[model samples]
Target: MVSSVNNPAIAMAEKPPSLEKEPMADVEVGIAVTDEKDDRPGEGFGEVSDLKRGLKQRHIQMIALAGTIGTGLFLSSGKAIARGGPVGTVIAYTVVGLLVSTIVFAIAELSALVPLSGGIIRPAEYFFDPALGFAQGWNTTYATAMLLPSEMVACAVIIRYWTEQVNNAVWITILGFLLLVSNMFFVGVYGELEFICAILKILLVVGSVIMGIVVDLGGGPKGHRLGFQYWKNPGPFVQYLGISGSWGQFLGFWRVMGSAVYSFSNVENISVAAAETENPRRNIPKAAKRVFVRVLLFYITSMFVVSLVVASNDPGLSKSAGDASASPFVLAASSSGIHVVPSIINAVVLTSAWSAGNSAMLGGSRVLYGLAREGHAPKIFTRTSRFGIPYVAVLSIGLFMVLGYMTLEDSASTVFDWFQDLVSAATYVHWIIIAIVYLRFYYGCKKQNISRDELPWKSPFQPYATWVALVSFTILLLTGGYTVFLHGEWDAETFVSNYFNIPLIFALYFGYKVFRKTKMVSLEEMPIRRFIEIYQDNPEPPEEPKKGWRKLNILW
Candidate 1:
């Protein structure tokens, strides 16, 4: 039942409402049923979402898979192997993967209960402080804006691998135009394209792993077995910065943690467009539960295979080609005298870059729309086309594509590296905010004597998992620029890139807090019960069982 008291603090100032006492006859399911006369778009759930619920179960699953399996894994893993060696690289990725699993569970629990746009940003306002909501909303927007241009620049570099005669500007412009056009139409258009791209990426990753095994077993044209020879010769860890000792090996492992963060950057974006997803309470949790398995299967397994087939000291791993030539899989295949791997890996990696840009565009625009809904941004961003596309928000973020032109003057490879560091730092900040918001939500439940069984979905390791993630992400963020502190290793660009987001988020948080005078919502007054009531009232239909050929399809 929609409570007559819109303000949870006022409703619970005296005592928590008994479930039996609340009326349910007139309560509408799924959407808010408030009596207030606010006509603003998305002011409350009562009016129904103006955005189309065109995303199906498969679309949500593929988007979750597509967002994380991009240029981070395709192109950047080479750098990780170079700096950390085989064993160190695996350790870094494994640690980050476990932390990311906890984040997925925390967000899944929250998004399952209150599946709103802007992902965790909307919940931050109701469960924690409104100022926090504003800060994270803009933090995500800024990060996504920077990400789009980075992907566009990557697309240009990928094109140069085939031929250098064509100017990089030409590829950037073409790719930028395609990205803008794809997001301007109905969201289903974007979903379908992502579905196709995700399938291609899955195939490529699996194919590369199998090929790596073949090369390692002396099944290649060269007939040379390379079973852990690199690890034995070069050792299990790198002596980073010409330092020679166990300490240097440890630093090498720690350094790869940042690169690991970049590889796993957008794994939490699965629920960003919750309002546009059909039966999100069911679909979101399903996707979240499967994410851990996907990470292990697609990421860790690939890294293990790459380590076995390719040496850590391969000169091509550090090449500035910014294309398939630098991919560890491509390098391994070429060394084994296999001629077909480069062209195939290059084709898929190119699409992966473009797909990453498309995802950033969609995510950034929806976040802007959610910010406008909560009055954190200008109202103009709330405007949508008749097709339910957020046109104004799309155009606002699309303008950032112009940043890709910087590659024309400077080296494309250099520009791509700059964006990699900057975006990775921003991603750490984003994950930190998610952990904080989840902790607040978890405590809010406890303070009110609400049972975890009552929630739509309760994650496995509450409070504890989130706590570990919070501390680990903070350390990573602070040490992201540690190389600059070493003797004769200072780089102004590196320091600024790693540390800039720290101050930017603080300024946004306190600025909004002081100006708006928004107070933190007390734990006792959190709206957990109200959202629980909504979930109970809205019962989704049972999923149909798969049959015939569909039964074989388990990827989703």
Candidate 2:
């Protein structure tokens, strides 16, 4: 049933003639898209679908980078350091970082092949069950929608460090408008804004680390040589729930996993823009790889530096003050008598929150659009403007941005905490589903005789790595609210915040299953071969040439 395209490169629905012994050094992929009828069924976008290919390679790289560096790093790390202490916090983030890298690699490999608009959402349907795809698509959309409010609220809180005179709603309204404008204009605008925001975040992280070093070396104005003093005095571990000895220390490390996971929540967002990026087959894998390395470096190095500069027992580390002064970087600088650093850090966090909110809009709206296209949501949600913006979807999610004004009636810190717990557990569920999706794809590849070498990006030790991350994330999800279960330590809000998402995901999964009468896809029936064929049909443009010392750019 394959087309008789003599070029071989443009053949659709054919099995690869043979697995290459070694990876193809540079396969010439055409820009030619497949004929509309031959594209996957039940996935409704066609050749004329107006979602513009406006995101360039740098856009995606910055999108992925901006996705990871958010309020979680700038603000929440202080709380995590307080709970887990310096050493425990560092170890916890490192473990979660590695696990995130695994997930990123797995997604990168699949995204290189599929390169669809919805990213992992379509893969779930293709590889497993359509019902799961429906559930995942909506869950991701909801999580992302909720994140918009979360980041907006974070911005409001950050602004308080400078002036509490302005109403929280005013700040939320302004930031929300900014997010809406950035997304509604063009995908390229979103990319450009994120690129600039990501650079700012990068500067903040590097500057903070350098400043931490200077303070530690007694080179700063305070003349305090901190070195490992905090680690030694606080002794590197905080006993959780008053549990003594090794068990308590273990719990301390385990506790920070939630924060670590939250910080990396949207790293997978790189692939969500696949449909809008040119040459997704090449660019997505590249972006995915860079996201992992850059996010890891920013997160791990910042955590290490924070550990050195701020004592875990510092009251400031545990302070729930709704401002950037509570951020560990600001605290570290303040301790070394650097008065101006707090406002500087505050400005960076404000942009970080804005950037995070922008990503939420892009990710959430696209997921909703994908759901509509797949017939999981209302068809009207799929409507796009002449410029390719999903106007309806964007507006639909923008309505939820008003949730940021919740901080007006409640304490900003309290509202932020509530959103944090919800997003943290939801993110764990997302990761678990990603692991399952990858495993199913891996098995289908094996069953269909698709060699790893034929993939756009090959991840080593595949099935095993996926399994480990799957189990670990599942464990984390179930235990995310362990403190709530501790004797005499229970709070209804905490318990609900941490564990509610577990049942909600289950409800969505089963609710969709029953509603759709869906069944799991058999390995033989999965369309791995069709996707590979589709990938072969479209050749990517040659990579843009790098000029001068720009050729030395490794972060991108």
Q: Identify the candidate with maximal TM-score.
A: 1
Model 1 ranges off by over 4 Å: 1-48
Whole-model lDDT values for every prediction? 0.82, 0.78
Q: Write the per-residue lDDT of candidate 2 for residues 301-416, one digit (tens) a residue.
A: 88998999998888997777757877998888887889999888889888988888888898899888877766678979878888889889999999998877755535767666
Error in Å for residue 498 of model 2: 1.4
Cand. 1 TM to true fold: 0.93
Superposition-based RMSD of candidate 1 using all C-alpha atoms, in angstroms: 4.3
**Candidate 1: tens digits of C-alpha lDDT, residues 30-78:** 1233323233322224423468777888999988875678777878899
Q: Positional deviation of 524 in candidate 1, in angstroms?
A: 0.7
Candidate 2 runs further than 4 Å off: 1-33, 36-48
The 10-residue segment with the lowest total lDDT in model 2? 23-32
